[model samples]
Target: MSGHPVLTMKDVGVCYFRKRGFLKRQKIWAVRNVSLDVRHGETLGVIGRNGVGKSTMLKVMAGIMNPDAGVITNYGGYSVSLLALQVGFLPYLTGRENVFLSGMLLGMTRTQIAEKMSEIISFSELDDAIDYPVATYSLGLKARLGFSISFHADPDVLLIDEVLGVGDAQFRVKSAAAMRSKIRSNKTVVLVSHNLETIEEMCERVVWIENGTTRAIGTTADVLRAYMSQVKGRAVPDPAD
Candidate 1:
């Protein structure tokens, strides 16, 4: 990665309002004062237990959700997108139709979607099913189609949630290869996953988040070592170890 930052978050925070029935409501902060930078062509992994606001941070970066505090700056006119399963699909629409719809939602033009339809369908392996309504698709099918469309969208910055965990073994391998191809093309990626091994393999750096805050951020080895130590209920090992 170069010295330039593609995207940067400065003291960002997001909150949700939960209603408890009658007149009771509570304000919960999903993200808290998290600051980080995403550099060009770097694959940054975010590893954490569920409900730690990692996904929320991606939403903020993708401009889907705004932070209640702080700021997110985008440099170089980069386009950011969040790729997650079971999203961006219109249940009543056919897979072909949803391709256009979803692509548009991801900021692609109609002409671009038309041009890439064949490649998207082939990559998704949805052949005949591409004509069927998305609601009729199985879980794995949804993941395959969603991932194919997003991966081919060619965004400047891609924020991947746990969608990679959804597909079958073979498809996972294919998808991982596609992601590597994107990385090779010098695209910026922010990946959030429960699989630390994949994070270690795919990411140059990893961020460990706990309870809506950054627990550690550094090289993949350093951050994952610290994260795994906590997971196993042991003290963090020395860097030399």
Candidate 2:
């Protein structure tokens, strides 16, 4: 699938310091044994419950956070990401400035960023608000702009968080379309979204994380069906027999 895998993870685990006792510092593992391969040109959907370390997985992929165990290999261009909602934006800066900042972080020259500025603005659909301070924009708008900037970077691997819920309905549609365009370009996309329908539609494969561990990894339809079945019976009240 486009030569070799663009991203590979094996026995990857993340741990954080919990407390420093008189004897030692206790650690907590947020995710464990997350070995996965992201072949180029494929979308890998990671779905999990809230606070289940989905964001931490993406961070590991992006090299923002290092793992306590296991190895991660990447044989592609740099991993540019919009890992969290509005993560890369500076509130005091205008949307336009953030685009350049993003490009710089992605290792682009100033001229290169300028070349794609118009495209990002159009894709984000923030024409009127582009020059305004980002803090003035809504959460959805922030997500849209952040995504547009990273999308235009044309990275080999793109890690997107749940920011797809940003923007108005029409803008959301546009963002989804842009996402499809990225997939068609054969870029490796690692998407973390709570919208199960979007996951089913966009992902070629799904990895279901449960309790900070990979409980299932397979076809989207199969995983979703099993996950829903497990979730459905849990919330139902017992009938008065």
Candidate 3:
């Protein structure tokens, strides 16, 4: 299994239902006939417009959803899905307690979380707020805490949905550095973002998805250049001209 891909998909497909009637069902695909590979120590970036199933693809890899048709093989262990920040979070719990709970769900024990609690709080910069109930936190604060907790889990594969929590100018610079650091590990990271520059900087390879299908896959520079060219031509007509 040493040579096996960290994650592999073959002829994958997923469909959602559109209500025609209570008894009759209609299907709308979120991903169709998509095949790809993610190798250990590499970051694979998936980009597409809204509602194009970017998050759905990551969920399938994270084993959150069973594809309608396809084969996904993982040698062993778990993959972390960050599609929804703090997905299983309990509002009643304090941020610190929630972090511990999240770590445990990721397969760690109390002792394990005890070993990394300080690092988690420190990295999140939550400090005193860590004792506050998560339900009382703002969206940004929640996102930050969730990201911090996940980082403490020591994931083998980290699937991130959006870079919303990566913050502003200075934070983005720092976040890019963090993304680079993650890619260097013997782990797989699959990122989905609308941030073209972030994708270009962090990913060596890319998969272009459009309308539930893989439109293209290739080196970052080439795929991105194509994406930009397509978008540039569609720029609104000049009113002055």
Candidate 4:
């Protein structure tokens, strides 16, 4: 991968306000003092415990949410997309209609979506269900549609948040293969996953978040070693083992 940074976050912070009675509000910092750079054509992994602001940071990176403090710089004005299982599909809309809706939301032109419509539906294996209302579809069906839409969107920067385990086993294999192909093609990706094996296999580098802050950032092997050591409270295991 090139050393050129495509995206950079400097001391970024995000906070949320929650109602605490009639006139009081509580402030909760989701991300605090996070600094990192994503190089061009690199798959960066983000690993952290639950509720640690990893998802919030990704939203910031995707420009879905602005940071409360610090700055995020995007070089070359690249388009970024986030792929999560719970896509914002209008429940009452048909799967086909939602495909157009979600595809455009992912930065695909309407014409482009039309060109790829058949392929997306075919890949999703929704078949006749493609015409059914998304509200009537099962969770797996929704995931399939979401994955298919995002996969075909082909954004410059792909931000994935635990969407790999979607659908059935066969679909999981297919999705993983597609993601690997994208990564092999030098597409830039930022993956947030709890599956350490997936991170170790796909990511060249990783950023570890703890308590809404960056705890470690380095080569996959090194950072994972430290993270595992701390989590296990024991000496790190040999990779060969």
Least well predicted 10-residue stretch by lDDT in candidate 1: 232-241
Which is the leading candidate under lDDT?
Answer: 4
Deviation from native of the Cα of residue 111 in model 4, angstroms: 0.9
**lDDT by residue for model 4 (1-241), tens:** 7469999999999988999999999998999999999999899999999999999999999998999999999999999999866467999999999998988878889999999999999999999999999999998999999999998889999999988878999999999898888877899999999999999999999999989998888889988998898888786533323
Off by over 4 Å in 1: 236-241
In order, candidate lDDTs are 0.86, 0.78, 0.75, 0.91
User: TM-score for every candidate vs. truth?
Assistant: 0.91, 0.83, 0.84, 0.93
Ranking by TM-score: 4, 1, 3, 2
lDDT of 1 by residue, 70-164 (tens): 98999988999888665579889999999998998888999999999999999999999999999899989999999988887888899988776
**Model 3: lDDT to the true structure:** 0.75
Total backbone clashes of candidate 4, pairs 3 or more residues apart or in separate chains: 0
Ranking by lDDT: 4, 1, 2, 3
Tens-digit lDDT track of model 3 for 124-232: 6778999999999887677666666666676777887885445445545655566567666645778888999889977867888878877777778878877777678
lDDT of 3 at 179: 56
Name the candidate that leads on TM-score: 4
**CA shift at 173, candidate 4, in angstroms?**
1.5
Q: What C-alpha lDDT does candidate 2 achieve relative to the native structure?
A: 0.78
